[model samples]
Each structure stands twice: as structure tokens, then as C-alpha cells.
Target chain A: MGTVAIYSLFIINKSGGLIYYKDYGSAGRMDTNDSLRLASLWHSMHAISQQLSPTTGCTGIDLLQAHNFDLHCFQSLTGTKFFVVCETGAQNMEILLKTIYELYTEFVLKNPFYEMEMPIRCELFDLNLAQVIQKDRVALLGR
Target chain B: MIGVGKAKQYANVLDKPLGRGRQEVSLSAFAFLFSEVVQYNQTQVDNIAELERRLEDAGYAVGARVLELLCHREKGNRRETRLLGILSFIHSTVWKVLFGKVADSLEKGTEHEDEYMISEKELLVNRFISVPKDMGAFNCGAFVAGIVRGVLDNAGFPAVVTAHFVPIEGQQRPRTTILIKFAEEVIHREARLG
Candidate 1:
């Protein structure tokens, strides 16, 4: 019925360039240049976080947030980022982000068609995600 | 590993709760680990069939251990002698021990006496799996095949388990049928024994 208020999603490469982007909700609300620049900046911050990582062989950044929107970034242990963007006030975004990461790890990364650093194109991931987001949206809208 | 003495002591301390004797674990952990296994195999093999083989091997290993434990629980009772008997034992005891449920259906091959089929509406590993278009060559069913191989091997019946996504005349979720063909020697021995 309804959907989760996930504004957009992005995937940043290890080097911090924009690799993938998708807007699930109504678009044109945020400036395109601003989002891209933010992605770039977060990429840098993620790199810094990686440097500060106590564990050796640790990969990309995770769950970086700004004032207007929250950014959740999951880097594979190999340094690929799976990013999710949601409204700043969204509830339990972290759990949803973790669930998405789990799905990616299970469906996308495990998929032989999914090459490293390539964009995800697993049908199951998309379908299950849509269902989860839709449920969240309905709950949010109802509230 | 916990020492036998410690294990027994702990078991004694928690007598009432431990009386049930079985432990429940989070299925999520198993799913995550299984996902990694699929990914690791995907990296090594080029084609779907090979990947399934790898999964089957993995399951075979687990099955061997499961069979030993099940028998041990039975105080090291001898394995089943007949094909139907062994299969029935696997469907009920082995399946319940591993997957927590028996397979959906167990049918004899109409054409071949030595061949049998186990159909599962929802396989444990494939329950949450959605194959990406790029990896169209691979099937999640291989892991299930591996599980079957494991169960059979432990029961002293060596067989080849192949996973297939066969669409029946009317089915919603893809039906995964594991085709089990016992080794020629096994059937030959059965005939000789008779």
C-alpha cells in the first residue's frame, strides 16, 4: 500500500566517485549538484574513516549522516559501498540499512553475475526491497 | 570445544532446561553463513552445474557429520539396508535433524527403479535467495543437492544428488526437485544380496 520514506540511494566506489544512484520517492526536492557533492565529501570522510580503522584489511565507510538527510554507507570488506539515503527524521533507518546490506551480501555479492564494484542487478534484491520499503512507507504515512 | 567433563557438568547444572537436550539457533546466522558459502563457490566455478557440485560437496560433508551424530544418538545402531528404508529414514530422521522439517514429497521414479525424487517447495538455502540475472547459470538448488548427498553418504548409500528448477504445470514458487541416482554398485549389490 505505502512505502518507506527512503529519499534516494547511492553507491560510492572505494575511491569515492559516484557509482550508482536511485531515487525511490518523489524527486526534484533536492538539488542534484548538492547531492553529488555531498556524496563526494562523504566518500572522502569514508576514506578517512577507513584510515582510522583499527582493524587491518578493513574496507569502505558506513552510515555517514548530514543535517538534512541521513546517509548509510556499507563498504564490503573489499571496499565497495552500498549506500542508502533517507530523511533525517526517519525512524530505525539503521535497521533497514542493515537489512539492505544483508540482502546485498546474500543476493548480490553471492550472485556470480555480480562482479566486484559493479552495480547490483539482482531481481530478488529489488523485489524484496520494494516490499520492505513499501511496508515502511505505509506505516510512516499512517502515523 | 567444551570438554566432555565440562559439558556434562554444565548439563547437570541446567538439568531441567537441558532435559529437552536440543538447542535452538538463529536461522539468520545459518542463512548468512550459507550465503557466504554460495559466494565462495561462485568465485571458484565457471558454470552453474559445477557450482552446484561444490555446494553438494559441502552438504555432503555436513551430512556425514549429521549421520554419525544421529547414529551415535541411537547408540551406534547399524544403518538401513534397503533403498526405500534408507530414503525413508533420511526423509524423516535426517531431514528433521538438519532442516527442521521433512521434505515436501518423496516419490519413486516411474521409469527407473534405482532413481528417486525428493521435492521441496521451499528449500532452506533458497528460501531467501534471488538469483541475479548475471548469474543465470547458477542455481541455488545445488546446496540442497549437497545436503541430500550428505544424508545418503552417512547412511552408507553413496548417490549423486542433482538440483533442478523444474516448473510443474501449475506452481507459484519455483519447485526444486533433487534427483537422486544411487551408484550402480549399490543397486548391483542390492540385487546380489536379494
Candidate 2:
């Protein structure tokens, strides 16, 4: 349970450029170069997925799993990415992503200070996100 | 029998269609729709003050129509005459008509005769809002201010309604209080009548 932490969140523009990024929890979790590289790679992957998609409009990518960790990327119709990184066996990943999406819609996106395609710095959003992740940890511990 | 027939005929002559009967709306629907309206306006507006002004204007429109409908729905016998009388009427009757409940408290300014206030522990539009830090300039209560303005305008009491978040002790969510300042003409008229 303690092993899970949201390393960062990123928003990718439609053309596959890194628009925003924020790192939470432990300092130096991901280096500057790594963060930028990951964002660019994810942006390109997201665009490719959209182009290859038979259906019209943008959608989300399936959970990407590797040996060390897992990357969960959810995209909005407008091509916004709500990226979450967690342990391989982390439960309720989908629910966590949905809740973050809801928070972005209500607090960040709706907030006037949040410029389009800019990084999010909403205190309320940060607090809510922290609370949600903590709750998930507690639930996992109880189980 | 003759008198009853005459009353019925008079009612028929006076009755006029002002649109459909009152429609029941879900509180959730109003809350969500209003939240969207605030969000939509927040995007276009430049600052907190302008956003609030736009919200007040929006509420003013609704208030005008709501006040008229409320007066029309009354039995037509107990119309308000005095300034305070109409102010109370606006607080209770008009508030209930729009928000489904009267405001928590209504008070007249102690120092100024023309100033009044309506305090609600939790204003409806702000119930779910947690203003993002970047958008520190946004406040959902502007919509409520607009509604108050509408009620005042429709009632022929031109006034400015400003919604503020004044946290009170033991309150969880931010408390919204609407300050209404009446025009000098209203005070003058009240004084003359007295």
C-alpha cells in the first residue's frame, strides 16, 4: 500500500506535444530529462492511437504495463492526458483515473486561472488528489 | 346562487394566461446546470469582479421574471406596499420560488436605512465549488447575486446585489451572504410615506 504514489500527471496536446506536467510525493522521483522524454513518447503514442482508432474523436489508451511499474494514461475527448503511475498489482486503477478526471473537469478545467494547455496548479485539485490516493492506500492495506 | 355566478363570471374575465403552470425541477439538475453556467462564464471572463457582475446580471434576469410570476400567483389581495415589506417579500417569497427555500436570515442595515442583507449558510451554486488556486479570482456565488439582483429589479427596487463568502464559526462549507443596497429613491419614498 505504501509503495503506491502518483509520481506525476501530464496533459498532452492533440498534436502530441507536452503541454503540462506535475510531480508529487518524493523529490527527484523522475529526472527532468526522463520526465520530458516520457511526455514526448506518450504524446506520440496517444496521437498514433487516435489516428489508428476506427472511431472518430479522441479516446484513452489501455493500461501500459512493464516489468518494474505500470503506466495508466487516460485521455479526454479534447486530448488531455491524466497520467498515473503505480505498482504492478495496484487495484482500482480505473476508478482512480476516473476520479482524477472528474476533479480536473470540475476544479482545474473549469477554473479561470487554468489556461488552455497550460500546467495545472490548483490547490484544491492537489488536495483532492492527495486525499484520493491516501484513501486508496488505506483500502489496500485493509484488504 | 346568483352571487356565486357573478363571482365566477368576474374571475373568468380577469383570468389571463401568463404561460404554463409552475414546473417542478430537481435541485440536482439546477445545481449541475448552474455549475456549468459558472464554469462557462469563468472561461470568458477576465477577472473575479467581472465574473461576479456577469453572474449578477444573469440572476437579475431570472429575478425579474420570477418576481412577476410570484406576484401573479398570489391571491391578488396581499401585495406589498412598504419598502421593508417588499424586501421581506423578496427574501421569503422570491427566494423560495427560485431556490425552493427561504434564505436563512434577512437583516436590514443598522447604520443605513437603505441597505439590507440576505445570509445563507450554504448558497446553492457554491455547494460543490472548490475554486482552483490558479483561478483564485473565481467565486460561484456570483450567480446567486444575479438572482437577487433580478428579484430587486423586477420588483421595481433597483439595487446592487453582491455575494460574498463570509465564513462563520462551526460552518463547514463557505457561507455566502448577499448584500443588497437600495437606490436613494427608495429611501426617499419610504421617508416621504412615513
Candidate 3:
């Protein structure tokens, strides 16, 4: 079994705009402007990785590993990319990302007042995301 | 660049967690919210068309979003490119996802070649909605029709979707028939491409 502890979550829209950004723990600190810049930078990097592939078309990157943290990316059919930053060697990352995508669809997209491609500020979405993060508290604290 | 510790204050805001739950919301909450949406629009619109349009507009965003999510959830994330394929996807998969079941029936228009119909015996959105006679020819099913239109339009099939109340024999409530009239260009393209 693999241990997983998520640190932060980022959602980039199809046009490389940062739509939603949330931090789960005190893992890292970056200002709003810096985060936005990093989001777009990562978005372009993802696009470049897909293009640089030897194959004619690439499905983009799904996961990235680093010394202290790991990044798992899930791209929806509509081109929205959800990035989850978890501890190294996180297990069941796929399931967690899938649940997060589902939550975004349900709480954010399904919200009547939410405008498309806007910075997600839905109260329900935040609530559900917090719940998901809380459920993994033990794993997160173990890190 | 400043010390990383200074930036820590920004992350401290979310230190405490909030409410809980996944996708499912309370039915009573949705009922109240939907009722308010209808009531708020009813006060603003002067005619049935405008009211229905408002409701449809509300559902349109939902449909557009659902189409993408549903496509993502499907195996291999394959999208429906054909007319019949998308219609079936919306009728079966989309309906099941949104309403918890497939629609009652999907019928091709006998009179018009460019039309299709999805009939529902009783729509969930309209379950609690009781239309007053004074309002005249108002059907909440227009919201669902709007959603269908949203899904279709987002999938590159531009069409006009309208809801009609067809009374079934011995049924207390009228069945909703969502009539979809495809654009002439869509029909032409389908014929040429198919």
C-alpha cells in the first residue's frame, strides 16, 4: 500500500487560466500573483510536454515527482486540468483526483450562479473540498 | 525575493476545515432553491416564452458542464461525434446522471425529418412545481429542454429545444416532450457526413 498526503490543489482552465487554487496544509507559501504565474507556467509546460512527445498526439502529463512532494494531474475531456500536490509515493492518487474532479463538477460547475471559466468561489465546493482533505488528515499528519 | 516565511501568512487562512460531503446535496435544499429560481424569474418575465427562456438559460449552463463531465467519466473519454450518438448519450447517460434514470422514450419526428423528441412521464424539476391556470401554458420542463439544448449546442449541434406538455390518458400529470428541431445546416452536414 502507498501512503498519500495531499498538500494543495490547483485547477487550470483550458486557456491556461488558473480558475481555482487551494492549499491543504502549510507545505508551501506563494502569493496570489506568483501562484497565478506558476499555474500558467505549469500549463504551458504541460502543453510543451504533450507536444514534445514522439507520438503524433500526446495526452499530456498525469504525474510529476520531486524530492519533497509529488504532483498528480488529471485533465478532463473539456481540457480542464486538475493538479493535486501530494506527498511523495502517494497511493490511490488516481482515485483522489477522480473524486476531486467529480466534486468540482458537482459543486462548482453545477452551481447556478457560477460562471464558466471564472475563479471558483462556490461555498459548497470549498466545503466539500475541505471534507475530502480532512478525511486524509491522518495520512497528511503522518508525513 | 523575500524570505519564504513571510509568505506563510497567506496559507494560514485555510488552516481550519469547513463543512463536509461529496456530490449529493439535500433534496429539500434543492427543492427550495429551484422554487426560488422559478419564483424569482416569474416575477421578472412578462410572457411564458421569456419565463421559459429564463429557466432554460439557467439549465443551459448546467447541461453544458454536464456534457463535458459525462464525456470525461465515459470509458476512454470518447466524445459523441455523430448526431444519433450524442442524442443517445444525452438520452441515456446524461439523463441517468442527472435524473437517476433514462428518459421514458426517445422518438424521431415522424412529420419533420430534422426533429427528435425525448419524453418524460414526470420531470423531477416539475414534481413540486404546480402551475397556476392564470399563468397560462407554463411548463417547468423548459429547464430540462434548455439543458438538452445546452448539451447539444456545446457539442457543436445547434438546435432549438422546446418543451411541450402532452397529457397521457388516466395520468394525473402531463408528460413532457422535449422537441429538438435541428438546424438545417446540421441536417445537411449529417446527411453529407454520414
| Top candidate when judged by lDDT against the true structure | 3
TM-scores, all models, native as reference: 0.64, 0.70, 0.51
What lDDT is reached at residue B114 by model 2?
79
lDDT, candidate 1, B1-194, per-residue tens: 34576554445553532132455566778776787787788789887777877888887788777766676564355777788888887778777777889888999889998899988887777766777655554567787678778878767788988887777767455778888999998899889888
Higher-scoring candidate on TM-score, 1 or 3: 1
Q: Rate the local accuracy (lDDT) of all candidates.
A: 0.73, 0.71, 0.82
RMSD of each: 7.4, 6.3, 23.2
DockQ, candidate 3, comes to: 0.01
Measured with C-alpha atoms, the lDDT of residue A86 in candidate 3 is 82
lDDT of 3 by residue, A9-124 (tens): 89999999999998766345888998899899989999999989998768888889998878999999999999988878877778888898988876666454456898887655
In terms of TM-score, the best-performing candidate is 2
Model 3, range B133-194, lDDT digits (tens) per residue? 56567687888999999999999999999998898998556888999999998999999997
True contacts kept of 3: 0.00
Question: Candidates ranked by DockQ, best first?
Answer: 1, 2, 3
True-structure Cα RMSD, model 1 = 7.4
Q: Identify the runs in model 2 with alpha carbons over 4 angstroms from their true place.
A: A3-5, A17-22, A31-36, A47-61, A109-115, A121-124, B1-55, B74-78, B82-85, B108-114, B126-140, B168-173, B183-194
